[model samples]
Target: MTGRHAVPEAIPQESPAPAAAPAQEAAPGFSGRLTAPLLIGSLLNPLNTTMISTALVAIGHHFGIGAADTAWLISVLYLASAVAQPVLGKLADVLGPRRVFLVGLVVVIASGLVGTVAPSFGWLLVSRLLLGIGTSAAYPAAMAVLRDESARIGRAAPRSVLARLSFAALGSAAVGPTLGGLLVMVVGWRGIFAVNVPVALVAFGAALLWIPADPPGRRAADGVAPRLGLDPLGIGLFTAALTVLVFFLLDLAHPMWWLLAPFAVLTAALVRWQLRRPDPFIDLRMLAGNAALSRTYLRHGVSYLLIYCVMYGYTQWLEEARGYSSGHTGLLMLPMSVAALVCSLLGARTKGIRGPLTLACVLLTVGAGVLMFLSGDTPLAVLLLAGACFGIPQGLIGTSNQAAVQAYAPARAIGSAAGLQRTAQYLGAITASSLIALAYGQSAGDHGLHLMAGVAAVLGVLLIVLTVTDRALRGRT
Candidate 1:
């Protein structure tokens, strides 16, 4: 699955090539000009996902809403992202990634402006929904760009290059709360929204300058008719199915089990429709045939389920049960972020995918087991150690699973595949939220933390089993 092959060499260009030149002629390696734009673009989704966490209270107070209402501020983004990622990814594949990426950034800028001046909570929801859809374009579009660059260069993307994208996402997410808090302190919750304008503008400018223009004849290259079809019915069914599923998952504490009926029906209809289309929005048949890619998505989803459980649940436990201030808890959690950053670099340097993944699962299991020993009086060192244990796996799993997706997915479908990968992660995140809500209902006490840890431990063990038994991953690096 490593993308090494002999192909025609192409000269690297810092500036845009003429429109007549083939789009794939830009570079022969993952150069700075190429990596810079992708790195900046990739930061949007994770940054937006976490940054809003710190501002929820201020937002709720300002709008005179309860926790449940404010909670939608978070859920709405996840829901929108869950639907938009693949849809935009499909558009990127069809319309050209550069175009889709730029449009997405523009949408982000507009969303930020709307959010900053939102007159009511409903407008705030609209802002978040747009933010979700806008940010959704980055990762998948970047993935498609990377794949195209790799093909142009005739080599697999170096692990380090791939890791840089992971680093951007992880680092941005790690700092989101701190950054958001500082912005809120200096300029109120509006700062969180307003800040996106300049950052996105810079990214947009860089992207415009550095990223190569799309080839003029994509449809021609594909040997298809000049007019392209986007499979709208498939997209609509997919959106409906995912929306129903996300809502059901969001309210798992008091689940609307009846929603499952519609979800199942939509999914079945989607499957039936997709199998008949030459250009389905989601290529279910490809997934059915590609067991390795299918497993990659499952592994990614389960791995994140454990990670979000720790990221969100453990922090709540620290503040509520251990009697730490939010600031102190954030400080304590710093070790996890630091460890994840360091290990991501280290993981990128390694060659074997299964080994790192196996090690990650083991560490995850050990971390969960350590959580079992925590109490109000547990030493600070022990807490830090637990955090590091979980952090190590986070870095390893993220890069490894990403590489697995790149290695396994069909070249033509890389964009949508990457988007589905993110959808898997968001689903895991939503599931983790449900799990935390169930375990820590009124408060994140010692017993609740331990109960959650037990579940996490079981999940970690399952990850280990999944990793070890997959023959497709045995010789992959």
Candidate 2:
């Protein structure tokens, strides 16, 4: 949860004052100070997520765990982040994005410090939990902050703002594995976490200097405590539903498929509870009422499921089965990131969502189909070419889907809508992590790689079909 939902009447309100007038700031597309720091802050989340991909094999070796057991490192972070992003977004709205953003940076700093010296896998897991909760704040809060600026200035959000945010996220993710590989070789696996400290500090200092303070009277009355507005019952039910679902998928290789019954029951109960609540943590009603919004959410989820499977699953296979050094693997993976960066920049000129989405699906299918041919002896050039194929979709999906959701959602609920989009993406990530664990129970061999690619191909096909059939995506915004 990133930004605050609408407050109930009984609850105290932020000051009714209008935002400060925009200064005669001069920047070609956006306010440089604001955009630069926000972009830097946003980069932390995706950078950390993908950097860990390259370091996973080393961490597993150090812990003496199999590939399946080691996957918890990735899954747990996404799980925590999936739940945290919207909550923090809500907090940002209630308190202030500046305060929440600063708190998140502090948490990240602390997480990095703890993770650097952890002696056991459990301790590292704790750090990742902190990282997940901390890093989740920046993007949604950034969105809220930008929206506030737009309203205050009597202008729409600059197209460059969303474009830049999307670029930073995907660009950072594209570079993370290669960067992590180099860092692993130079300073060992712990460098992956330790490196966050300095970068986060820079972002903190920059944000403190650049991001504006909230307007006067923009907080709950000091004497009277503000209501949290969280539905404890709904949260419990939703958490249980997601927990059981993820666990069921993770345990698919075992006899725990029966857990699906409880998961279904919990999901139904959650929907019922949310429908009745005035301020549910997750607005199930909105999702159900808005078909286009719902489709965007599902599409984002499946798109991420396919990408992360390749990002993490492929990296593991390259190292363990193909005998490539982490550094070499990172280099080979560069084509995907570079291609994504290029395509994202190009795709920004596109007006409607359909064209980019269709291209994304096509690229994804091609990439996944190519993966079917991967083997221990696959040519390096061919593998790099395949990585580039995957990269094109990576670039397109984030930008295209973000635009679609922003266009489709109601004006007042944009914050919640953005949070939901992140939730969907992270949920897909969690599913991908579980699938990775199941597919590569021991090692990422030919069979596992082929199966994962097939899954990606299926997701790509579904996305293509959705784009073709969904009218919402066809019209210009």
* Best lDDT among the predictions, by candidate number: 2
What is every candidate's alpha-carbon RMSD to the true fold? 4.7, 4.5
lDDT of 1 at 154: 48
The residue-level lDDT of candidate 1 at 163 comes to 69
Model 1 over residues 389-434: C-alpha lDDT tens digits?
A: 9888888888788778767776545556667888898878777766
TM-scores for all candidates: the values are 0.85, 0.91
Candidate 2 minimal-lDDT segment of 10 residues:
7-16
The TM-score leader among the candidates is 2
Model 2 sits at a Cα RMSD from the real structure of: 4.5
